[model samples]
Target: MTTITTRTVEYPADGLTMTGHLALPAGVGRRPAVLVGPEGPGLSDVERRRADALAELGYVALAFDVHGGRYLDDIEEMLARCMPLLADPDRMRGIGHAALDVLCTEPRTDPGRIAAIGYGTGGAIALELGRDGVDLRAIGTVNALTTGRAGEAARIRCPVWAGVGSEDPIMPPAQRDAFTAEMQAAGVDWRLVVYGGALHAFHHPPVDQAVRPGVGHHPEHARRAWRDVVGLLAECLPVTQ
Candidate 1:
């Protein structure tokens, strides 16, 4: 059985207490870990499952909670909590860096080889973490709207793999093109994929049914995107175990 572990860590920012999950390969010794930033406002069973899935693939994974202990039950509430953080930008960086600290300091993680993956808003945080010169080896983002922006693209320090849906209204073709241009201009190592006919939150299969019509999810695209993300991580942050 893969050895999965979890704990609650306080992110001294805003006196927030976050409950996080860490999963490691069975018989591991300082395995590389992926610090997973939550989509917005918190951690969910889906995030935990992603961590477990990463462990199953021979890497340690830790999913951090951004919502403290408050879980939003609807889009309105979720957006309310996420808007301010996205607007401030610094709060996004602070929270992402703080989560990274919690993941790297753990004994089971290899400080030299940790990376990050995020979805939607969390993806933005992961990209920010990469741009902030954190010691990340790779970054994977799914259905991210913010990655294509100019200022953030300039700060990335490692290889980036961004997956977006062909039909995603939030991150349409124009935005993807712009983001591609920005990455090229920044001279950052990067890859971009637009899954045909897919929609937003492509990798999030169990997204609230209420969110389905608003944000489509395609299991095939999600799986493909995940495989691509894991492959990129393996290439950029090899597991030393």
Candidate 2:
């Protein structure tokens, strides 16, 4: 196993002191970096572990925070905070950019070689960053097939890859179509994968908290999605040994 380092980082976003997890690879020189976004409930051990996994793969990774170090396990509470935030594109961009700033500031990060990968609300934030004209090599999202303001997607300069469960009510066929339409109209290179028989947030491991309908885990699909995301990164932001 690669010898990696991890730490907690604090940064301000959306009027909150966001505490994120930063993971550094084993080797010395600056390496490609990736921004890992968590589900709407907020950052958890899941995302932090993903950051560590990315670090083990030789990339500097930062799993960003959305709720100021709090994890909302209640479905209603999660929606209460995420709904309004999702409605405002600028707010999402603010959070994404803040995390990007922290990632870029790391001495080991290759600022120019970066990609964004996120789940649920975090996925939406990644798409928002792409729409905001951020220079990203790639954008990979799962369970967040959100459409942006008209013409905004045209600003996205990188290839985008998205994954969703076919049975995900939150991101149903209509939402997926709309998202794809927007990306197509903008002429952005993009791809979408539908995991059959899966539900919303299928990539996430089972949690003890109560979840809304159409939210469950599929261990197999979860592994597949991670492989897909890793493949996307390898193609767009390869790490040098």
Candidate 3:
């Protein structure tokens, strides 16, 4: 097993004191970095574990925070806070840039080789960063096929990969089509993968029961999605030992 280190990092975002989790690989040299965005509620064990997994793959990973470290367990509260925030592209960019700034500040991070990936609302934030013209190596989103303002997606300089469950009511087929259309119209390199028979947030583990009506876990799809993103990182941003 590869030895890794983890720590808490405090940063500012969306007018709150945001706290994020950072994980680094075992060795000594600078490495490619990844920004891991959390779901709508906020940063939690799932994203932190993802950072650890990225570290195991020899990259520095930072799991960004939303809601200032608060995880909204109530569906109504989560929607009330995230829905409007997600609708605003500028606010999402603010959150993403704030975390990106922190990641770039780390000496261990190779600023030239960075990628962003997220789940749910976090996924929207990653896409926002791409649209805002950040020089990312890749953008990967799971369970978030959200579309952006029509002309802005042209700023994306890297290939984007989005995954969503076929049965996802939240991000249904129309939404996926719209997202892909926007990407194609902008001439951005992009790919979409629809996991069959899965529901919203299908990549999530079956640890939370307080989910929306159509949300459920498909462990197999979750593993496959992880492998897909890992493969993306390997292709776009390789770290040499």
- What TM-score does model 2 achieve against the real structure? 0.99
C-alpha RMSD by candidate, in order: 2.1, 0.7, 0.9
Candidate 2, 1-241: lDDT as tens digits:
9999999999999999999999999978999999999999999999999999999999999999999999999878989999999999999999999999999999999999999999999999999999999999999999999999999999999999999999999999999999999999999999999999999999999656675688999999999999999999999999986
CA lDDT of each prediction against the hidden true structure: 0.77, 0.96, 0.93
Model 1 lDDT per residue over 113-194, tens place: 8888998778888887776778788988887657433466677788989888888887888888877787888888988988
Model 2 residue 196 distance off true place after TM-score fit, in angstroms: 0.2
Q: Which ten residues in a row have the lowest lDDT in candidate 3?
A: 203-212
Give me the runs in candidate 2 sitting further than 4 Å from their true place: 209-211
Best by TM-score: 2
Residue by residue across 1-241, what tens digits does model 3's lDDT show? 9999999999989999999999999988899999999887788899999999999989999999989988888878989999999899999999999999999998899999999999999999999999999999999999888888879999999999999999999898899989999999999999999999999888877546665689888999999999999999999998797
Task: Work out the TM-score per prediction.
Answer: 0.90, 0.99, 0.98
User: What is the lDDT, from 0 to 100, of the residue 221 in candidate 3?
Assistant: 93
Indicate whether candidate 2 or candidate 3 has the larger lDDT: 2
Which 10-residue window in model 1 sums to the lowest lDDT? 205-214
Q: How accurate is candidate 1 locally (lDDT)?
A: 0.77
